[model samples]
Target: MTSELSWLRRRADKRAEIGPWELREGLRSRSSELRALLEERKLEHPQGTPEGNRVHRFADEALSELENAERALTHAHQRYKVGSHVAVGQIHIDTAHNLLLRLSRPSEIVSMMPGILAIVQSRLSSDDPRRARVEAIAQSPESIGEPERETILDAVGVARQASIRENLRVRSFVNIVGWVAGCLAVAAVLVALMGAVFEDMVPLCFTPYRGLEVGGYVVVCPVAMNPDPKGGRDINESEASATTPADYLVIEIVGLVAAGIAAATTLRRIRGAVTPYNVPVVLALLKLPTGALTAVLGLLLMRGSFIPGLSALDSSAQIIAWATILGYSQQLFTRFVDTQAQSVLNAVSAPNAMPPPPSPPQGATSSAS
Candidate 1:
């Protein structure tokens, strides 16, 4: 008996180790085994005998356990879906990278200043319109003083804006994709809970006539079906009900509420007590929702697979943690992007980078030197 108990404990441990993928494969095996065992027992044993009843009970229990395992796997998949919400916010990083690259173009042009200046000076007498503009740029940059320097800086600013505008369509596409991904995750939670609504509304009846059978699996309607008096058909249009997975609504509700809480917390932390009116109003409105959506998606993707210490809130807490992490993360990311932009600007305006045409010394030069 002690040996048997030890074996059973080992089996339980193995069962605990089974992840979503493993459980899915095992479902097919376990289901086949249960079916075969029942068929063998039915063929060999008398139906009414105690031994036959015991065998049937064992098979039924095994089948029930397999169903439970499938349900647990489904729950894990759902959690991962929620966790991935946070990853959707990665669009910001992608756009930042693209802008940084565009900023490099101006930096590259500035790096070759000596050649450009020489070309402009040599061709200054020519009537070519391009050379004329280049002559104007090369000649009085320092001679005309601080105002001319400011013009150069303004041109750089204009170039950056143009680059951003050029990629507006691509950026917009990314935003739309991100929003759709977030909405799909939210919809998944709703679909999971919708099962409970069906269960509450539909009444079940035990009958020998199965409503639909295909591929050895049966799809049973939740509502009762009575045999037609004259035709004797089992199908009834009015009595049929949609089948829903049982007992998942509570978890779905808890996850959604947790997502909302995480969103509120993120807004409080990132935007502070009040959003700054100086920033774009559209951005201010989106910040809270985007943070919350990313957090919820992140939790779903990461925590759905396992409920660590406890079952339900493990996923919810995961979502909140992601939201908070991302809110703080924006602080670091904002600094990083700014630093990249500044470095590019500096590269475009390096020391003695471009020789100014001979002119009187000016004390009020721009600091970009």
Candidate 2:
């Protein structure tokens, strides 16, 4: 049993180590396939004619871009292995993605067939028997005139440019969200550290009006400190010294636990997105810190008697329970963020598929009618 467990642990560690390498390999394989396709297309359509020349040019350009992308991916993998700056890895990944997008141009390819058919129909007279040839070529593009080819290429180029812009927009949004989440997480950590170091300055102890059975009122705190019972009617905030830095840390920890649970529950809703920017991961990270902050703030609000009915907590357990509740309540605030993230993910059309073609020009449709 021990040997089996050890083997499983080692296997898990190996899997973790290979993650970046797997990504690099996957991209390399894709680049290889694209390169082969480009080479074949170049062979089929030589530079003897205008369309062939264009094909040759596209193949050369795409191959060059593919090489760049492979270089970027290699650099990224190396940096990832060396534990270099995360932003450097991100830049390399973004470059590779952009280069690959240019090379593949799936949207352009999808638009090409229809665009060619449109161009052919527009140029050839309706009575021309060559119209039948247009349909045949549309089914399987064997040949097209230079003029019609240029028009189709122009339209496809426009579609490719639009796809690139859309990709950039989605990438930008994901980056912004990731940066914001990271900042918030840092802020939460700082706040917790500050509270821990300067416990007296930032005490989280609360004294209820209700007195203890013995006589005086006892202060309740998240931390497990001996309660100091005041002889007076009720112990005020200033008089309480039982609260320690652990109080804030305890609440933060509880909130973090709750947030983790929330994040786990949300995994069902998270769909796998094709883009490099993992929005769901970013949102999950955001929730953790937000939950921590909320937990601390929620306790503070309760201590200040902000919430009328739930002003006073009876014991340390009660305080911690409330912290957990408040921590999970971060979902209430972050749900809107989740919704927006989903919308953004949905807006990102698949890079490997074509979007719907644009509507015909106003006058062109009427003219055809």
Candidate 3:
């Protein structure tokens, strides 16, 4: 065992004197040396004595190191051959291929051997059996001219730039889609608020007299009416027929579009304060029927009646006017509105306790305590 260890140490020391080519030529002899040492260790350590076991371990380590050194030498020799003959681009390709093999399996050659593949493609002009060996070495034997290398690099650069441009275009398209979605959301909210402000403002049920005299036919104006016996009539035929219901509907739609723009503008201003970046603002005009329905529900919780002087206008006009103001002042109103909603919820949950007093007027100043 001691003799085996001394022999292994001498071989390891001799490894430092050999070049990669010389090492490659000596691989067979070295493998034989390892095999011989392993056999001697096994015969002497049949029962696995401590000294014999130590000799076996040392031989195994030496064998493993020798195998690794052989592979290193082979790769170094291959690279030397490639660098001396192949063009700079081809050399790069060969290096990349060698790295690929190290990282993956031999089966991965189809995808990992692009440089060798390119060389083969160029060699289609000549029918040489030796070209087959280039695949094993994973490099080209013939050096590519400067013009060919430049052409290959240019083509690769162009393809890379095209891919980058395509990515940018996709990103821009996504951003546009997101901005349009945001606009639609804003428009929907504005239309909803408008409907809520005017839900009860217009007369829903009405009556019109069709009775005619013998001499002259006559038509009575539409009069506002309700199904409830307790309800009172509020509007005359003149106001109801002055503009058709369809016209009012149209006005409401137009107002919603304008409100969407106003909302978008307000949002842009708020965003601008936080960041210096700017983009062209476009508003979505389409309004969903559900928005109008939701507005009807919102009307029940509104703070006050229509603003002063707005009463002269039609119901749709009045709604649009109020919606515009609310859109701009949403941030100011939302906080108090949420607090009031919570208060209402609390009052309902505890029916026995008295509801809290309404918040004090914003205009009223309290004396400092």
Candidate 4:
């Protein structure tokens, strides 16, 4: 009833409001959603709708509307108008073919649903699934037949079960990735703090920090390279005087190495399931966190050289530290998203009754009585 009303409501709406192209696409994509919903109702009470004559009336109306739509398309083509409705029909017809295949073998196409339901401004088939489901319902319970109904329901069940199996195979990897990322973030913070503290340890004698006076505090340089030529001292201690700071280069290297290892691990986990396109997708997202931390550390390194900042690098070290944490944090993000997606699928999997196998198109004269 809801589908019928919604279709009718959209019908009254203008071509401008909702293009025929989109209507066709929606039908193609939502065929299963409609079928699944209606199937449940039919199984509980396997008979035609309560409204008898209304079904006949709509059939007549649908036939008339189809003819008018055809005529409008022909006229648009003849006029060569960019606004021609026929071009939209052409698009819909092609889309219809794909939709038909999906309906026939839903298991093969369940993965495609996420793609189909995506935004496509127009529809491909003249007879949308919603309409077909309604018309099928309107026809006597015998029109679809008990046998065909059982077949459809069985197919729906199988398709759903296959999806469950596929997701279950990959779920553990997703969970592991999340937990590991959380742990890596904490570990990265502690390791970076220890590295920074090394910059302050002059008494221990590590690198140039072995002996130096920075601020009122005893500044210990970790490692100072070839000093600048412009300044003179036994060493370029002038710039090195203010305070000791961390070596950003080391920090960035550590972060990159950590993120790279993460990427490699993720790639291995997704190897079998992902297509070539997924490779680009996964790599691109992974780099977002890695590259961000790298740049942050690089920037901090430059800033630390000039400023009389606190021991260890400038505040940017802390910034890079957090960002690197996020770099590793991406593992958590992907796993979390996949888990949420799985939850939604689980919600839709259960059902009370099965759908019927869809019938082939009847002859032009109409045997839908």
Quote the positional error of residue 289 for candidate 3 in Å: 10
Tens-digit per-residue lDDT, 33-57, candidate 2 = 7677778777777788997777777
- Worst lDDT run of 10 residues, candidate 4, spans 117-126
lDDT of each: 0.39, 0.65, 0.37, 0.39
- For model 3, how does the per-residue alpha-carbon lDDT over 261-321 read when each residue is reduced to its tens digit? 5445544332211111111122122222222322332222332234333222223334455
Identify the candidate with maximal lDDT.
2
Model 2 spans with C-alpha error above 4 angstroms: 1-27, 37-59, 76-144, 211-214, 225-239, 350-369
TM-score of each: 0.24, 0.68, 0.24, 0.29
lDDT of 4 at 70: 47
lDDT of 4 by residue, 73-149 (tens): 44422332322343333333333333233233334333333333221101112243532442343344334444544
- Model 1, CA-based lDDT: 0.39
Q: What C-alpha lDDT does candidate 3 achieve relative to the native structure? A: 0.37
| The candidate that achieves the highest TM-score relative to the unseen native structure | 2
Lowest lDDT 10-mer window, candidate 2?
80-89
lDDT of 2: 0.65
Task: Tell me the spans in candidate 3 whose CA falls farther than 4 Å from its real position.
Answer: 1-143, 200-369
Model 4 scores a TM of: 0.29
